[model samples]
Target chain A: MDCWIAMCVPGGASLAALAEVEHRVLGLGEALGGAPWVVTHQVRAAEGGHYAGSLQTQRGEQAVVQFAELADASGGGWGLVDGTGLVRGGGEETHMAHALASAIAHRDRTEGRVVRFPGQADLPEQLSLEELVERTVVEDVVRVGVAEDASPLLRTNGYVRLELADGRVRLPVIPWDDGEVCPFEQRDQHPCCDGH
Target chain B: MSGRHDHPHGHHHHDHGHDDHGGADYSDLTIPDTELRPADVSRRRFLQAAGVVGAGLAIGGFAGPRPATAAPGGGRGRLEGLVWLNGDHHIHTQYSSDGLYTVRTQVEEARRHGVNWLVITDHGSNAHARIGVDKVNPDIVAARSELRDMLVFQGLEWNIPAAEHGTVFVAPNSNELTVLKEFEQQFDGTVNGWGAGTPANEQHAVDAIRWLGQQMLSGRTPSALFLANHPARRGIDSPHEIRQWQEADPRVAIGMEGAPGHQAASIPTPNGPGSGRGFYTGSPSAASFPGYPLESYRTFGGFDWMTAKVGGLWDSLLAEGRPWFITANSDAHSVWADDRIRPPGQDNSAYFNANGRYGDPVSTGTPRYDRGDFWPGYYSRTWVGAADRSYMGVMDALRAGRVWVGHGDLIDGLVVTVRGSGGSNPPGTLGEKVTVGRGEDVHLQVRITPRRTPNAHGDVPRLARVDLISGPVTGPTGDRDAMSAPATGVTKSFEVRGGGEMVINHVFRAVDRSFYLRLRGTDGNVSAPGSIEPRQDPVGNSDPWQDLWFYANPVFVDVV
Candidate 1:
């Protein structure tokens, strides 16, 4: 699947509300069909009165959505604002359901969220909360590059460590240089771990 | 400044009247010509002829008492009217993004644990500069009024532009908040989005310190002080930065954390907040100063490796005859056994920004060692010998280096004096210099009072031994990152017997030029020779109450 999915929550959304939004996004795979998939989302508290994001879903088209109060409308609910900024004439629930279904159907190519090799790959079409936590660890470990000037270093810190399977794995979060990998020199220097 | 002195054979009379180095400049305190040398008289005449008098700071001193006195409780002439107030400067409250408790909660807990003075240092976050500082101000003022006996200061845990966190506090006044807000807005690396260690950021840090000094001088605040916190936690506070900070503004940037916070971090996990000693668990990073020895990355006997390593970075600073001091702090965010936890319904934004839901504070009867820190006055403490309880008095005492730091309630009180080899001469305490004749010997007298009651943790700490360390006071080195101490070592150790108050004396033979001596005592729970790492319990398993130690500032001896 190759597509984009974007969403925006109303301003002053509570933590519970944000979690609800996350739950909805994570369940997109099951909503579309009984399928195994991965998705990545960068979540942070929004400052202004609205939260907006664009996601590339499996629908082959990236869709951007926003959840905010409708301007000048007497009664309000979710509706598809056309590319020309005109809302489609439909009820909130019907419009929201249709928009989500279409975005979910537009799938991007799937890939592993955590890889064993250095280099960034494309983001997965869908990611679960469990998988999100796993990706954090993988990123943390790989982020601690072996050399002083590690080519593919993450601006944010490193990945967590739990299990290591064989072969060279790669994750999509970092931009590792092509055909360049330094041995784990930091492994010998670290007081505890041997980065093997 | 030359030829009137002799050494080696060491038979010379030390006037103890005037000093050329910086130790509370007392030229005006003494009557003119009382102890002026023929050479000084001639030089003054030459300067007067050149019409160069009154060109700079007049070297003026207020009418002050003589610098040295005898031990009061044990002997004669000890420093009088000095009260040892147990306090901490590096503390955090809910105003900090990562901190958890409110100002009232922090002050109440600190007072319950016997803290007479404390500085509330919330981290320098964007919100802190925008509104957090103002939000915490009223609570701080209310706490000060309610806790009338305690001195509460509003300060920020600054993310030093190129280094680690430091405590930058101002004397509480109408303009205090304004000064602090502007300072943070302009200099705080975290708030300004320039915290990453870089050359420009390092210069900004130096400029920030100098600006604090400017504030004090410009009367925006009556007084201000800065102390580097958890200096070696990340090994990013390079020796050059420490020196440059002091050089930038000696009055504003005075000392660093000798023993960092997170003292209870040693407690095993599932019960303890497992950050290891001083929360020192991370491997060296690109920003880390490369000159730090391997041992500098770990803690020894619950103290930071810089102070624990005898002749390490601290000694290097002292060796340079600079007034670099060190203190201990709880850096308390949440105390060990704290029961409140952030509810599942709230995210970090609401928890910190809006002060959302948190579990009700529970009783201490339930043990939760998983918490990483002890409240102010709970475990780590710095006892400052101030003249009064006011902000400036405390700042003056801190600037003068009249203080001692302890961990786990290691001792109730520590009194150390360096005087002429006997009870006949006046005594000089830590951070003061005692003048001695070329051939004369100097003695050190230490009086330690064991704890009368258990600490907040309910542990009764006992002293095992006190070690005295001394080193030559050689001025600044050529290499800024130098960490070697070839001539510094532990001179002697006094073992403690069952005690109420123990007084011991030591005498150093044939005096030389400038040098310093310091003190440290431990409960014998953990011990290591020189700079070796102390034996720590297995990770995720240890008790905060078992180990204890205390360190006092150094007293210098100047040979004339």
Candidate 2:
């Protein structure tokens, strides 16, 4: 039931440690909070700009965990998915807080979203961190991932399919030549960005 | 028309590329009945040998991407394949007050999303006009090649009443939609409004479109591609409009807009046919239109965000083996927020620039028409399937049914290939199907995969379903005299229900721009949003301009 779990500061936040990282976290502690869940993540920073982070929850299971802004840490990357193959309990785990709101979003409502491992990827150069996150967000939207309520800015919170390379992530999409008309909003009717 | 300027003897191309996703298959179904005529196809091949598209692309390389998805099973997929591109043919500009755009900016944005070629076909019916292209097309080509790699071209859209009930397309950005508009100008005096208190006519609309088709195919080839602009969406008394149009002309009215604006308008009506003093109306539905005061009008429904439902029309035309293109126009009236087109506050001044001043010296400078707001952005687009990336090349590629309609996205990347038992192609249409009345077991196969586009916010739409609208005919000539009757169309559909990867929304993700995967349904009636994204445009029955979203002259194969 935990809406969010952050190891360190969020996106682009220059943080030193994952949990102690200063960043904004949403929907944490929304689920059963009786148990404690271990967290790990990465953070990023742009010289003077505030640091940012991304949630990479894995292995541990808890209701919610706050990964506040990390003014006290260096900037670069956010949470890391506990890939230790650690035995993390199961429940309805959502990708992001809003993912938990929309049933069509995450499969783990109370448990946790099973982090996906990179099978193989040909990561490109000149790829910036924001662009990497942007790509992941795009991949998720392309796959209809991320719950409706998921923040448009949180590429990972909405099931962004990130392809981790050297030390970055981005969506893997190639333009097509001929095919059916793009479904309306795929390019035109984006609900998240429409000016209303 | 005299003061107009266009690329005198040239055309430009933009930077359109294909989507890079895993492959999609259409081999499970039968192939098209007839393919493009060898000689004509070869004639196009000859043009390709000359590398028109390539040359144009080399020149207009700056025009963003305009790549077409390779049609699978087309043997060419066997030929090392090429990249997918996109294009948007039917767009309007500030010249049409009801619109919101300009030629330069229009072409610029096309480059931004990587649309190679763009045709600015503003509403010529309206008297409102613009000071169009100068020595700028080539400059645009050079600049786009330098910037977004997009192509820019000159095109004029005629908006005369479809007495013929048709919409026509022409070249030479300055070339007015004279065929029909001229007569109106002469007959009605005023050009854009309810000219001399005249009601919109179908005959005029049809003749204009049909004639364009005739001119283009018959060798006259007036740098033009006349298509029926939102035919079924507006033409009332369906049967009457159809019959009259067909009788008048039948050049190559490809398709009407499937989704012109970002979303088709949904009209609302009273609970039931409110028996009025003189008339009756349909049942009440959703309220979409804002200021029109629908609450007061009870006899009929409001036609706000109208998306054309011309399947009945396209189906019939397809029977003859003609592959008319399907298209969409933004037909927007406003852009409230970021004119650059972001989410949550899209207020395009093209419809009515917030700072528009009716008289005096108009702001003449960079971004011409962007601030004008008169039928601007999000209103025009058409796809072509050509051997090379040139006008003639794409034209030849298109007449053969290898195209799609993208209201906002360019029409390059996503390609549509229908395979039946006939030759895989034709000159005017795609693979030929026996022309007969409805009655025979025919198999159709369609496939589409995800492709990349301008992922600004990175929100891609999920293809809920691939709708196959089989009947409908279009062209400059109104609805080509084909009377629409209360006839039910027999259909065969295929669902992309194979792997969990192919499922939509849940799992099946279409990286490709469009959603029509050549699938069929018992009674394929998706919500007003249909396969289009956003699905927020009001759906209504009133304003014919906005409501009618999509239109395609299906490759109809009669089974008698």
lDDT of 1 by residue, A1-196 (tens): 3343434333222223333444444454344332222332212221212122223334421222222232113122222232233333222453343333322322221221211222223324334323443663342234221232433323222332122223222232311122122212111121210100
lDDT of 2 at A22: 19
Per model, the share of native interface contacts recovered reads: 0.00, 0.00
> How well is each residue in B356-415 modelled by candidate 1, as lDDT tens digits?
223334444666666678889888889998766667667767877889999878898888
**In candidate 2, residue B300 scores what lDDT?**
12
True contacts kept of 1: 0.00
Instruction: Quantify all predictions' global Cα lDDT against the true fold.
Output: 0.61, 0.31
Candidate with best DockQ: 1
Q: Model 2 over residues B60-106: C-alpha lDDT tens digits?
A: 23232222211211223221232334566555544433444445556
Worst 10 residues of 1 chain A by lDDT: A187-196
Runs of candidate 1 exceeding 4 Å displacement: A1-196, B1-78, B342-347, B350-368, B421-426, B529-538
